[model samples]
Target: MLLRRRRFPILQHLGVFSNPRSFLLHPLHSPQYSSSKRNREQLLNSMRDLKTVDAALDFFNKMVAMNPFPSVKDFNCLCSIVVKMKHYTTAISLIKRMHSLGVKIDSWTLNIVVNCLCRLKRTVFGLSILGLMFKIGLEPTVVTINTIVNGLCVEGNVEQALGLAERIENMGYESDSYTHGAIINGLCKVGDTSVAIGYLRKVEKRGCKLNVVAYSAIMDGLCKDGLVPEALGLWSEMTGKGIQPTLVTYNCLIKGLCDFGRWQDAAILLGMMMKKGIMPDVQTFSAIVDNFCKEGMITRAESVIGFMVRMGVEPNDFTYNAMINAHCLQNQMKEAMDVLDMMVRKGCLPCTVTYTSLIHGWCKIKNMNKAMSLLCEMINKGLSPNICTWNALIGGLCKVWKPLAAKELIFTMQKHGQLPNLRTYAIILDGLFKCNFYSEAISLFRALEQMNLDRHILIYSIVLDGMCSFGKLNDARELFSCLPAKGLKINVYTYTIMIKGLCKEGLLDDAEDLLMNMEENGCPPNACTYNVLVQGLLRIYDILRSAKYLQLMKGKGFSADATTTELLISSFSGIKGENAFQEFLQKLVGV
Candidate 1:
């Protein structure tokens, strides 16, 4: 038998193939083939009912060794199944193996790989594959290049994607409407509306049909750029072009008009959208309602809600938040609460914005207790309070002279991983200073100093005002000296605070020096600065100096009020009897 098998080498190869079936019948050959074939058949059966990629991958490995050389069709089937399953790594491995085994990867297979990479957000790998395809002389179809362009746009490399689009055109690949739309949308996202409009016109000249999505993108860009009139014109042009506007298109235009305070025009557009039988979506009604709320047209805003419900569109959380914020602005907390109850009853779960609006409303009424309760309720409902929520609470507490409570709340925010922004810090600092917690205020200032946040002129002024109010004039002057080192140029407020500080300490010479320095620094002294200097000199019976400052104040176009005259009269009264006082009053008042 060995001699006969040696003589027929073809039969030797056939012998290996024939054993698998014969083993099922007579048990003569190796059982590996029969078991592998069984597993492969089982894998194929499982693939038909495959619900997830992992299960399909688990099955693919069992049958991999069974096929010594899978046909191109078989490899293609595997590639298609793996791609559909999103088994990208395995799919790529299969493609590479097929190439090594001389299985031709056709254009369809290449496109599938590109698409798979795009879906996986591995567009760079997809582009590398495209380069490989070119190196191997595989012709790229238009769909393949479009996939690349779309992927690039999604990755925010739109400029390079546009270059690729141009290259596609240079390669004689026909451009499609989808490609134009992708480029237009990408350009609009990057705020390059001019180029986006040019592309839109190019696509229009090419007779490629413009869809609602494309028109909506351009309208949104125009709206964001504050070109509301131009956006409305384009809306009309879109309708005139025989392309019906989608709900998104109407929402964009209505929102644009509303943002620009063109409520009358926005209302007309809303009615027109309704008249056109394009059943207005929730966003459309929300936009109009928000516009009405912004204009303080509460009755019109309520009518919009009623119209929305009548039209079978349920008002969402955003709609309720808008009404609540509007009522809050008007200090109508009861109405805002009523809207909140309505929102809850409608089964629309309130978001942080909903709670934030209500909290702000209570804060507006100086009802910090109610705002705190709502904050606790927000936490109980499992909503994480954002920075705005904390800011409102802190600011409200500060307004009510609860600076200690505000500080505790800030610590709570820090423990919860919410860092106080600059505005929050400023509010707290100002609150502490107003409450006469100077030590604590200075500690906060020092802490901020260590953190190296840029020193703002407002912070410096607030600290200086606090120190000056507490009769710490030298400390206030030292703080001023350090301001320039910290790169903060003194503003008018800064100079005014320093002048008041020096004047309050009876340091008229130092006050005058600061006033001169203020002018030298180009921070022109306002009425307050001059008023401080005139009053300071007058306080110590320095009538000549006081009168000189008054004359300078008048020259600077600052009128002396009763306080100025009273200070001058008191100074003159100290100069022995009422004669000098009367003369000083006459000279001072020009009588």
Candidate 2:
């Protein structure tokens, strides 16, 4: 009965809250151990220097065999070191063995178990273990509870994390920097930057020195929300408080500045980060290059690529993709292909995005042969064609006046399990319209509506524009009237299209009414809207109303586009005020 009572009794205690960890290895039957204090010191130092999970396990097994077994602190220290290696599972395995051997476990040991469970994304089980700690006579500490809080934040259950933090604080426990950082980061991650900034201020007022993690996180949130200036303000405040910015801090601020086309500021920040010895990594340069590409500053992107080479920072896949995509967008296929070759030569494997961009570039120039060849090459290289890849080719086929070919590509992609998204349908609808398959386009759109797919406003615009340009004014008007019934908010573009259709049919009065109605209903006319209306009037030789709209365009600080200006100049034969057009041109060009 005594022997039965002592058979690994801690198993029952751990089993209630432990994971089903398959760590059932038995300790050696006659393991030897030295009583020499020097031997134990060697074990401790060796454990500290351990690098791999396998070696760490061997040390744990050896430690359990020591004559005067290492203290719980020694075992706890081994677990801590293993945790640093990010081998949470191995740490759990070690803990399981310790319990089976009846090594008196402490709160520190339970804290590790909680951390491992949480790191593995099992916060519920971690929370349960916290409860188990008390039942097994081990008091939970602030660190143990904070691990759960951080886990909750990581899993995006931020509201509950904040509530738990407050509950713990109210229970007379002083939360540390980790606790405060977790809550602040959670707020930022959930895109509640307003609440995050407020919480930051609240924490500062209470004398909690916000660390670099908290500042970087909130700065990231602010930057993502397009509040770059506000994030810069926080940056100044962070530096003013003598909190040294980390690589993450610099990366966030630099990326934010670059995104807003603030190149000079980004350059200055890059210099500052270098001066601080916090060298920007591959990600930082990639982001800067990406932003430069996005803003159509390909020359700047090329220059940055050169600078990256000079700084011994080899551009990664993102860097290559950005440059490739920028050249592709500008239809500079040679430059784009050159970058791809360089990427391959440098052993930087091109991803699906890489081929997709090249395919799109070739498509833009109506070179379906080159685009199709590249698609085959991409497949032969073991890269599967994504939806964007097919869309690029489909759009290319459409550009070549082959709507039927585009539709066939759509069916081919479906066979490959690459389902068509809304964008796919949008491209097809646009192609059909461009290729003069008006009835076919209408049928496809009707099918989409019948299927209850979320047909977006852009899709409707394509259909409306196609109807108007096809001289189906009555069909266009009926469809325009049905937009409001369909719960689509008529945007400025849609309103402009209707105005254009009305003017194309010589319905000058109705066109003028819709243009005036745009602002009354809170949708103001942009430069394009006014220009479209003017061009419509000029098409029918309505010089007087054209003059009125040109004056309105000037008043709204909108200039006439080249087409509108060309039409106005061409129609000046019926009017005596040719100087007025010249004068408007001068002011429009800031002369």
TM-score of each: 0.66, 0.88
lDDT of 1 by residue, 1-591 (tens): 222122222212222222122212232232223346566556555556756756554444444444454345555666678777766655665555444334556777777778877877777777876776676677888788889888888877889888888887887888787888888888988899889999899888888897878888999999999998888888889889888888888889888988889878877877887798877888888988998998899999999899889989999988998999999989999999999899999998999998998898898789998999998999899898999999999989988988878988988988778898888888888889998888999999999888875378887888889899988888987888998888888898889888888888888898899899888888888888888788887777777777787777777787777787777556655665768656765765653
Give the poorly placed runs of model 2, Cα more than 4 Å off.
1-45, 63-70, 275-278, 372-387, 411-419, 573-591
**How well is each residue in 1-591 modelled by candidate 2, as lDDT tens digits?**
322234334434444444343433544565656768887787688777888877777787688779878998999999998888887766776777776676777789889988987998878777777766756666789899889999999999889888888887886878888888998898898999889889888988899887899999999999999999999999899999899899999888888888888878998999989997888888789889998998889998889889888989999999999999999999999999999999999999999999999999999999999999999998898889998899889889999999888888888898778998888888889999989998999999999899876457888888889999899989988988888788888899989888888888889889989988998989999999999888888888776777788778888889888898777666655555677765654565333
Q: How far is candidate 1 from the true structure (C-alpha RMSD, Å)?
A: 10.9
Which pairs of residues clash in candidate 2, taking residues 3 or more apart in a chain or in different chains? Answer: none
What would the TM-score be for candidate 1 when compared with the true structure?
0.66
Error of 1 at 573 (Å): 24
- In terms of TM-score, the best-performing candidate is 2
